[model samples]
Target: MSNGPAGHVARSTVRPNYETGRRGPIRTFLRSADGILIDSVYDPGAVVYGSAENPADAGRSPTRDLVFVVAHGFTGDVDRPHVRRVAGRLRAHGAVVTFSFRGHGRSGGRSTVGDKEVLDLAAAVEWARGLGHVRVATVGFSMGGSVVLRHAALHSGTVDAVVSVSAPARWYYRGTAPMRRLHWLVTRPEGRLVGRYGLRTRIHHRDWDPVPLSPAEAVPRIAPAPLLIVHGDRDGYFPLDHPRMLAEAAGDHGELWVEAGMGHAENAADDGLLSRIGRWAAVKAG
Candidate 1:
């Protein structure tokens, strides 16, 4: 790994290992449709076998069979420990690709928060496809949850499956302390400054030119490709109604799991829950 712009860690790109019939880890920057450079990493999965290993490694498959592209929440990047933990868990099922949305890490441009982030995810998914994975699944958290919903709707049939966690059903105004503070964090100059210095997230000064599609509206369009909505019943950001709305919109094509004691997004998702999600992705992609 080498130091990238603004003193962020950046990994070097490596060629795929053809001899092993697997791809090597590749670290590179991807260009969003709007031209923002997104910092990304592709990790090949570790080899695993059934209880008894056969001469041909019977139940084992190559690392590139499926790829999970992880999209993190607001104020999150590919390098965050929580994000890394999530990626590490998914690696048990298949290859993992994680990237920092623009303005979050070494990626260029300011964040419009969630709007236009679809372009960033699109770029990452396109890159994952180019890596030659047989299947691709998108796993997103919080702000990224909203992004993945919009992305799957916007680019129908592009991804094989999608998992959204702790996403809002619509543009919400909860009057809750966390949601209120979060609004302030994105809407005010002082909050933006704190975000830049304290959180290392740069907020864009401008608002959406044309308001982007909301998660509720997007969910109805995500059919044909599998959708899984995972939210915490005790989530501080959004409540049970949010996931219910999304699942209702999704109709038969979507599945909802409201964890009993979970809180919110990546920080709240435990190892066992993440393992279950990884396994679900592996099955859906298969």
Candidate 2:
């Protein structure tokens, strides 16, 4: 719930800005609970430790105590510009961790879509905690959005805050053309070739043995953890009803923001919107 026991670690003006003085951006391979290799990156923002207490840092978010683990959309990896941009914007508010799900990018295995991706996010969150950030938040886009909600529900108090952007409310949604195309890509053998060589995403052929919990179904279980549901009014992949369903399931614990003229996933997210999200995560997670 409320940032666990370290929710209010005494902000001392003494610690060093360990994020800086490091050799380079933190990049490493992490192992999921299921032993899958996950490629992860950590971007330490330019803010120094204890800087939040400075008079000059008054208006801006100086969130050294928080880390945001960002989950990319379907076919997305940590290397993609859109995913990197999301990491860049989030780092302004705190340290950021970005990772490629299993079967995406250089990672091993095939994408089970939103089902097993929860393990990938869990691995990233564990790494964030290992980095010494007491508070952690997860921000996911589209497919990744579904992963974050399910991750929160399954992992319980592992994450302090959760933000799902442009995510579908349920699984196997074939309402939109994009959704239909996506299903074809995942379900068909030839389409799997397109996903592998064309999209650089290795999609699993087997269907979910047991369907994982849907985003809307998982929302109620994420209660007490700060949850933010964001969608674009003009999103092509999933309409406003998707976010509405998730928000309704969240009841009083979740916050919703519907942007005007926005599209879908990370690409549709602008700098201003990302900045607002970063600020919200900092405040809520801190």
Best by TM-score: 1
Clashing pairs in 2: none
Worst 10 residues of 1 by lDDT: 1-10
Best by lDDT: 1
lDDT digits (tens) for residues 211-277 of candidate 1: 8899999999988889999999889988788899999999999999989999999999999999999
- Alpha-carbon error at 152 in model 2, in Å? 0.5
Per-residue lDDT tens digits for candidate 2, residues 112-223, read: 9999999889888987787677889999999999999999999999999999999999887888999899888999999999999999999998989898898999999997
**True-structure Cα RMSD, model 1:** 4.1
Alpha carbon deviation, residue 140, candidate 2 (Å): 0.1
TM-score of 1: 0.91
TM-score of 2: 0.89
Instruction: State the C-alpha lDDT per candidate.
Output: 0.87, 0.86
Candidate 2 regions with alpha-carbon error over 4 angstroms: 1-24, 48-64
- C-alpha lDDT of residue 75 in model 1: 96
Task: Give per-residue lDDT, candidate 1, residue 215.
Answer: 95
